[model samples]
Target chain A: MLRTQQLEYTYPGNKTITFPDIQCEKGSQWLLLGQSGTGKTTLLHLLGGIRKPQKGKVYVADQELNTLSSTALDQFRGKNIGIVFQQSYFVQALTVGENLQLAQTLAGHSADSDRIKDLLSRLNIGNKIHDRTNRLSQGEQQRVAIARALVNSPGLILADEPTSALDDENCKEVIDLLETQAKEEGATLVIVTHDSRLKAFFDHKIILQ
Target chain B: MNPLTLSWKNQKDRPLQMLLTLLLFGLGVGLIALLISLNTQLDEKFKNNLAGIDLVIGAKGSPLQMILSSMYHIDAPTGNISINEVKPFLNPKHPLIKLAVPLSLGDSYKTFRIIGTTHEYVDSIFRGTVASGKRWEDLYEVTIGANVANKTNLKIGDQFHSSHGFTDDGINTHDHGDGFKVVGILNKTNTVLDQLILTNTQSVWAVHDHEAEEKQAPAEAVAADDHDHDQDHASEAAGQEDHAGHDHSGHDHADHEGHDHDTHDHADHQAAGPVMKPLIEYPDKDITTLLILYRNRTSYQTLSMPRNINENTDLQAASPAIEMNRLFSMMGVGTDALRNLALIIVIVSGLSIFISLFSSLKDRKYELALMRVMGASRSYLFFLIILEGLLFAILGYLLGLLLSHGGMALLSGYLEEAYQYEFSGWRFFKEELWLLGGSLGIGFVAALIPAFQAYRTDISETLTTY
Candidate 1:
């Protein structure tokens, strides 16, 4: 479960950048759609505990993120929030397995080998787990990023343009995977994207202008 | 990569920088180790060899110079004395008297000093019998030093003419009438004993026999002239007849002059038996300087002895223990300064490492955000950057140590040959080790900033940057 109240925030730079209020409960699929420079990313960052709002409170599973110490915030964020970036960047030195292992370590948990293998195999990247990251294709790398996000079975999953580089077929497949995983884990799923094509897949929507 | 693995990869990325850093550190570490090692070794040698029969009797001079020459076989000798002058203290039962070993310095065969003493020289100071070959059997017999044997390849039965003094140039040759035969080779004492050419007391006197003989020759000429009249000049007339006989034969004409001189010396030898020869008299030469070993060992002072001698004089008093300490402590300033310089360099290097990794982290903010989106934590990201810097520092330290020893090893051989002081192996001082640890600490501290920076990234801003 995740929620944000009144969530007022400024960019903390010279000019103020503010986020609209927001909340999400357990097992919900919410599409965060917004025009460019409409505080979508700023709100997403605040929600992930990366930026303290300077104005509002964010809660995940009823724990206030804004109140946590920087160190505590890091641990809590790593354990509870899963984010998919527009570009999935893996540690170049590590093999795919180590990338996932590091993710679990950051979350203060150990990797679930069987479950991770199961996810990779489902994504058709099972054999690539031991390979160096530079060897992976973009589609396969994105799948690994997804697997790493879900390694610790976090309470919430978030994606930024989760399928920006895929064809319609691959895009459909990635979205299905994220939705199915969130449902199976009973976790909240939130996606920030400009593509209205994925709008049908979500049960709720937050549109900002 | 695991942190170490990732850090190690940096060397591959900048091999030249890594190598340069290693070389610099190695030189610094190596020099320090070598100096300490030599000091330790010298201390051991001094402690071991300087045991036993207390006093060193030599000519009056700088007592320190006297001890150095007579005791350590180094430095110029104080002076020389007649063996007969030291006879008063030769008694084994005299009060305040213990067994004494006399040393006379002068002469060398190829830089190895020739010290004229009895077997007591080995018995007292060196404390061991010759490892190979027999002890000196004749006045002309010489003992090769351990280092001499190793370097010169001289074995028993080898003969070499000793120079008159400690100079290597063969300008002053000892005219001992008979050249010295190598009778023994001593074991490595690792002390100045390793550089001495030891021989009997007779050898010292015999080596200088030319001077005594020169003085005797003129007197003998006068005595021959006087003795001819006492024998009613018959022998002289017969000698004239012999000279005339040689001329008549003509075959012995060139030898006639030589025969006349031989006959003269033979007559003189027959007339004067023991009275003409110089002999050891112990106290009579007045031990120019006494190296006194006291029971209390509390101080260096002893009753001043007579300074004048029949043939010996220069020596100065010195205590090796106190002098050596003073010598080493004088280097404290240089050592402190060098240590400080090394520490500063290490700190600067650490700062460089921190700056390099920290900047790289900032540039990769989006990459880090993506990893977080893929489930990597701020701590994991933080550790990666910090570990890179820490690894760089550790590697640089190791390289410095190796460089130092390798360089020292190369230089040590040249130093020993040129300076006669051997260089040492890897030997870091206690304070030096602390400096090394401090360097690593600086590296770790420098890395902390970047690691913390990585921890506080705005996931959304960073993710969008991608």
Candidate 2:
């Protein structure tokens, strides 16, 4: 459900980084691996339509990201592309359940507390639904972030270095939770991380240089 | 979820800054509001108390003082004027004079003035009625004013001595054997008369008959003085020395029967044993001031009468309208300056809001970017900042408006007691609408810069800025 072709980008007065094409089918998990300077975050940002790629096309669910107007792209991204940032950034004022509800609202879907609670229960953080995200443990925050990403049942879920901050046991658990949630939603999961420890979890992989 | 809820959370997140901003804004709004309310109410009281008399004739002194004293009774009388000196205006047949009410001052009970004038002073000047008892008929009998009766707790048939001068505490008390009896009390007329004790001019002469004896020289004055002296002697014989003992009980039985029976009984007691002859006549004697009304205020008399009195006679005549205009002009300088300063403070409060919002916007960039990513439009974030500002404005305005009215109510109570002019605290002025608009405008202008910054928040950059 996601594709990219020769996607490249550049910062002001900085060197250009060309990315290899990415192809993924629905209900699949893929890892985009790179070192710190290899544009792993940049590629994920481009695929989420957060930035305009300078050279090539990014396609999610058959819609080209660059062809849409800025406003339309934002709407399309909210509906189809759910992104989990490296560090979980929640609107700290809202509880975890409210954060998930916000994701549904921003995605133009009506609020579904049952679906949100069910997702949290499956993620093993259901009791923490009413707790502020800041008060949650790191592993629980990561699980809540995954619940927010899958709350709208988006076709594509993009996670940027989400497991890099976890230890070995938490990392494996987070990756398993992500793949399980993605497969349950039949979504294409793309994780961009510099941590090669995640290499065993997915077969489809692209290495950025 | 919504912009309003988000903005509220944003404000609640920073309680100290919001409170400081609201206080500064409230203080500015409160000062301007208090000044506006006071200025409007004081102007209303001053205009209401003018009472339509055209000219005030008194001894030569400051025209404003004479106007304030003779017309408003808020200052000491310039000095006494002999009634003979103003006989031209006092004459009923005078061409320019419609009516002249002579006033004799220099005595008071507590803060209230005891004014000695004819019945025309009450009927014509105040246009009032006796709320209880009858108008004074005997020389020592007096009519208490509504405010005087209320403030001093004096009832009909209650006799009280009026000390010399206008001391508020009634110091340097008079030693005259018999004090003036409260024979009648006038209803509230909302004029200067409400703060006065009304008695006939002869009562004033009789009470100060000793002074009249000291200044006796003119033939007509000596005749009037003798009449007052004879009346004083008769009142003394009628047991004036026992009046204090009778009133020492604090409540008098004389007024319980609807009229002053005690004074009539004293008169009858003198008449039963010895024949006391009533005086033949009271000449147009000395008075402290004359309040003159024009026959036609729109005619040339409005201009020429005061000029004619000032240039042609020994008495000084001042038009109330002209003197009041001068007083307003003098007061306007200070009030206008204060009003302008309040406006500056309002502007500074706006700047404080701007600084507060602008600084907080820097800290909120990541949160704003998150909202943008969560499908909040650029305009939504902009409105969030604007809504926060308007919330502060609305809160400050409501509190400030309350503060001003509360302050005015307290101030009006003190002023009403000190100067018998009533000021209503519940009244609202149309200018307050402009004040509200100005405060909102300040909030809007203050928030514009921060809201603009919020609108331009770069989502990807801010999200990644950490």
Taking all chains together, each candidate's TM-score versus the true structure is 0.70, 0.82
Query: Per-prediction DockQ scores?
Result: 0.29, 0.50
Give the runs in model 2 whose Cα sits over 4 Å from its true position. A92-137, A184-186, B118-159, B173-197, B210-284
**In candidate 1, what are the lDDT values of residues B1-466, reduced to their tens digit?**
2456655653444566555554544444444444454455556655554565355655544544555556655555555543454554444454444555656655578777777666766766576568898776566678877888888788988888877445565545554445788989998766666767787655654554433344345555455542322242222123332112110111111223233333423343244342333334322222223333434333332233322232244333355555445645866677667766755665556656665666667656766775555445667767776776667666666666666666666777765554334555455557447546755676679879888888787666666553
Clashes of 2: 0
Q: Which lDDT value does model 1 have at A78? A: 79
Per-model interface RMSD values are: 3.6, 1.8
Q: What tens-digit string does per-residue lDDT give for candidate 1 at A1-209?
A: 77777777665475566556677878898999987777776777778776667776788889998787766777787788887766777766567887777677657676567777887787789999899887988788788888877777888888878887888888898898889888887888998888788988887999977
Q: CA lDDT, every prediction?
A: 0.63, 0.77
- The true-versus-predicted C-alpha distance at residue A176 of model 1, in Å, is 5.7
Tens digits of lDDT, candidate 2, B189-287: 877678889876666655665333232434333355535433443332243332112111111211222322234334432443322222113233467
